[model samples]
Target chain A: MIPPRRRLRRPPSAPWTRRRPLPDRVRRRLPLLLVGVAALALGALAFSGIGDGMVYYRTPTELAGHDAGPAGRLRVGGLVLPHSVRAEGDALRFRLSDGVGTVEVLHRGEVPPVFREGQGAVAEGVLGPGGVFRSDRLMVKHSDEYRAAEPAR
Target chain B: MPHRDTCPHSAVAALAASAALVTGLVLAPADAVQGEAQRLMYVHVPAAWTAYTAFTVTAVSGLAVLARRGTVWDRVGRAAAELGAGMTALAVALGMIWGRPVWGVWWTWDPRLVATLAMLLAFLTCLAVRRWHGDAARGARGAAVAGVAGFAMVPVTHFSVLWWRTLHQPPSVLRPPGDVPVDPPMLAALAAGVLAFTLLGCLVVARRVRALDAAAAAPAEHVSRAALGRAA
Candidate 1:
């Protein structure tokens, strides 16, 4: 049988202390409070940046009619006119129209397979003095519907 | 028998899953513009929605874990965070795949895309906190703190499409009041997909929590057995 004295010995663990490391109020709630404030601040910063950073999508008519200074690049979205799409080597030239007006786009890149005449597309670049929209990038946009209405031929 | 109670919604999830697949692939008419590539919406939207739901669960459970330290809360928080991270990764992948055929490029520095990617990384960092700590006791609290804090990314990700001009399209199904952006049938299908993914995510989290509970218990049992042997 184990000796009584030996059996009663404490295990090799840190001695139990009644004193708390910090007050109950400050100890439990402070970290969470700080985190919440920090998140709010960060959120405020992110939300504020959205206004000036946003690049609004525009159409040909809006682009031509806007008094907004040509501060930076903008996107013009519409359909490539039928028989207006032509490619010379890698350079592509097309006319995008939203029925009210059309813009000439000169792009040099591989177009999406879905990109074709009379399909919805967006061209991103600046409008030069000669009325040509020099686009470095082109994207095809589509309606979320399962079946979109046929484009007017 | 008790395990059966853990995930009571799996059957519903399976049903919804099948319905989504059928509606998305077979029943829905091919998109007049994108042809069949637009079918990716069925998967991408559902996965992203599920990720948002899972991360919210993670944040709530994280608060619980912080309020009252318990194995159940820890398990749930950890599992939800893991599932959220996985779903976010899959959503990003599906978006990229869809982008290639529709957008003509594999990727862009679009705000929404970048924000989603950042959110994914934040959750991953939460997971690493749970995994990399040398002491499991301390790690749980750290992970809970991180999980709760990381939730700030959710709103940012949700609003990124609207806040910036991106290569990505703006919200359609979840848009402000107007004519429904998608056809009625397509909306129904997308709803089915979201429901299926949410239920599936819940089922996955439940199983993971159960496994974590079992694992946590095993070590304690071993320590008790060793103590008992010493006493004997």
Candidate 2:
């Protein structure tokens, strides 16, 4: 007669019995945890120095005392000084004034048709060593009032 | 196949969108700086907002797909991404048209514009990868990773105007600090536009997801039927 197989007894203190499910659970969740951590890290890094790069729009008066670096570009909006605009070849020179301060502008492109003396305009460029604002682009600021006022003129 | 289930929000979305068009095109006053051309903002801003919303949906759904390994989430993610990419392209094109009249140029190396273009390209690539891959699961997993990783560009795009020397205008209505620079009426019109666009995007995505579900199920049903017939 074959000897009956000895019954295998489970050890209550065995590490494998206690830890098996935990590892399987951890393995299943590890990818998700990794993705979350990576995204969080990337977000933090991307926004870290955002303030330093933020370039706010300012009027001539507001931009008068501010010194962004030579390469720094900013926008100044205000009325174009009457008779302050002059064109030489392709370059245009003008002054933008906000009633309190006047910033000189030197542009090297075709000025927009709507841009005129005594009209509202915004200039975007870098500030030179002097008080001059060297602009590469000029935009005319036309309001509904300006359009309504145009037909009358 | 004819779609039997109609989107419940379709009528509401259509009504809201029509109202937004009227408010934006007729009721809203022209901008002081950009004049009539500024009207493009009504469409452009809303489109951009919708794109952002869609991409967020894509990312979330993508994450769900990976975690659950469900076809439902994968289809939702794909639909959202496709819609988001299209909206982003529309916004970019509208922006260019507006820029031509206001900024006096058709295009510029503005950081905001560049970032937005990059986002559009990245999402389009994600969709392409999903389409071309032969293995469904592998393709979906790859797309999910792309959808999630590509979101890193969204914050950058939104903040580029503030963070970089850009020709693009700064936030007027959405500024978080201080006061809203835009007039109340203008802000109201913009809000309406955003609402309409968001609702429209949701409707489209919902319909697309349902279609995808039907398509995915049909093949499985056919295969099961064929197996049963062979057994008989």
Candidate 3:
């Protein structure tokens, strides 16, 4: 042990040299390339994926049958469970369940005024530490006309 | 050592990547059937759509320049032509990445793929025209003609899907008589992808025009300055 420790203390010899500063042209090019790469990465992360892979939309029944893995972004689709929507200020919480299974969705965005329980809507985002689907983009799908219209009085 | 805006392509690249990210991560819907893997469609489809947009812009601009005569048309034609080319390259790249899983090939000579490849070669011909010609005024005119001729490839790419049986699925946006009804999330994602690409194309063209205008004014600066001095 003592001998090994002594050997470890003796640094492994290797040739090394300090590098000179980069010229202006090279210096300029590097940052431009770096920014380009970073932008690509950011786009990939924010939109496409952040390593784990891009989130996939599925019905609660499908999610119930499949392995979403831990920390995966999940797009859960199905009817907004009847009377399951409850809210506290901007946090609109509801349960979305296919006929067979259900997942709680916690979202902070404005609920489309026309969004009511038991309608076809899709909420997108990642799975939280708990089982809740944390949605960031919500679109309440209406029949042929997706754009929300004034509710009849 | 940092250059302004990093690299020459940084600005547009950042915008494209971020717009893609927003469409992919934030705006796009995940597939109801495929789940996370469906996210790939956002980039793949948009890349293809943007390529379409670029070619359309280039073709129209080239036609305008050929029909009329001005630096404005030349500039527009050039910017659109270059953008169309870049988008085509991006489309192919994203398509290959998506196809590996769904189609089992990195590339296919399928009608859609082949037509897109032709679109790319068409724009490249425009670049070639520019390279071969020396005088700015005459070069712009020559390149405009080439751009318009090359753009005929667009209709070829567009109809390739319907005209030939290929590995690629028929369009989901509007199905043929027997086309399956796509899941709601998929339609949403597709719409978002189109919108995002349109925004990106507009941003790219704007930047290209500004950069070109600055470049064009550079060579004739001494002449313009002397003219201004004489007038004064």
Candidate 4:
């Protein structure tokens, strides 16, 4: 015959058997409380530095107004001015415009294949003497607008 | 169990996804500016949209779990979190692949990119919380809370482009009351892709919820069998 079954027992000191300092409902809701607090803290942090967090790149007009100082590196985004691109030995020079102000850029690195006049581009570097923006890196910025290779039938 | 032998939803999802692939890769004309790289948008945008839908489902199901105290809603919240995290990862990877050629860098610290990453992490944390405690009910409760809180990331990520200057472009389709910027053929392809992905995501979530229910039932079945043996 099978032995009679017995319910499992826990020692008095076992964590589950120990007396709880907090009420059951409060203990159950602690995780939710923690999550709420964390979310609020993160929101606070994000909002406190929101100005810097939001602006990914400075436009030509914005950059012109600020004194970034010598040796300060920043990214300037604007449209490549038509007929402003010229080659100087290994480097390429182009004027970036934002319809309000324009900044001449001297990019020393390889120009992206998509880099073309009338298209948006962002250059990362510092301002040099004679009001020229010296760029070490260049990136093409395509607009949200998309068109077929040929006009839609 | 009646539908267990064959899942019609999976089959339909497969067909829809195949049609999307063909239309996106073949029928849609190459972009005038970005060329074939633009095709990545077909998958990238749909994946992001699917992720957003999944997170929203999780958030709603999480609320149900809190109010009703049932395992069904808990399972749904978990399943949705799983799909949301996976789709978020897919969107990010595809965006990186597209960005490498278009933006000249594989990654950047742009607001849109950072917000998307944070959204991915939030859902992943929700999934992890489900398995944190040994007690199923307690774990589900914690995960439900996480699911509700994590949804805050969705709107932040979606609007990051509009709220700030971003390397990423603004919305082409889900914009203000105006004509969509995408060409007709490209728009068709993208719409098809979104439909396919949404169907597929729903199918996966349904299957996952069923599996979780079965797993939850198994231990009770085993206990009953052992008790029957003792009675015999």
Worst 10-residue lDDT window for candidate 1 chain B reads B223-232
Q: Which residue pairs collide, candidate 3?
A: A32-B6, A32-B7, A47-B21, A47-B24, A47-B25, A55-B36, A56-B35, A56-B36, A57-B30, A57-B31
Each prediction's RMSD to truth: 10.6, 14.3, 17.8, 8.5
**On residues A6-103, what C-alpha lDDT tens digit does candidate 3 reach at each position?**
11122336333234445534543453355346545545443442123333346776655444434655566677889998986778899987788898
The lDDT for every candidate, in the order shown, is 0.73, 0.72, 0.62, 0.81
DockQ pick, better of 1 and 3: 1
CA-based DockQ, model 3: 0.01
Give the higher-DockQ candidate: 2 or 4.
4
Candidates by DockQ, descending order: 4, 1, 2, 3
Q: After superposition, which runs of candidate 3 have C-alpha atoms over 4 Å from their true positions?
A: A1-153, B1-23, B26-35, B174-180, B220-232
Superpose all Cα atoms of candidate 1 onto the true structure and report the RMSD in Å to 1 decimal: 10.6
| Candidate 2 lDDT by residue in tens digits, B81-169 | 97999999999999989878876777655567777877886677667656334457877888888899887778888888777655576
Give a tens-digit lDDT track for model 4, residues B133-199. Answer: 5466777888889899999999999999898777789999987788888898899999999999999
Q: What does DockQ give for each predicted structure?
A: 0.19, 0.06, 0.01, 0.25
Ranking by lDDT: 4, 1, 2, 3
Indicate the docking level reached by candidate 4: acceptable
List where candidate 2 sits over 4 angstroms from the true fold: A1-83, A87-91, A96-108, A114-153, B1-7, B220-232
RMSD (Cα, Å) of model 4:
8.5
Number of the top-ranking candidate, with TM-score as the measure: 4
Ranking 1 against 2 by TM-score, winner: 1
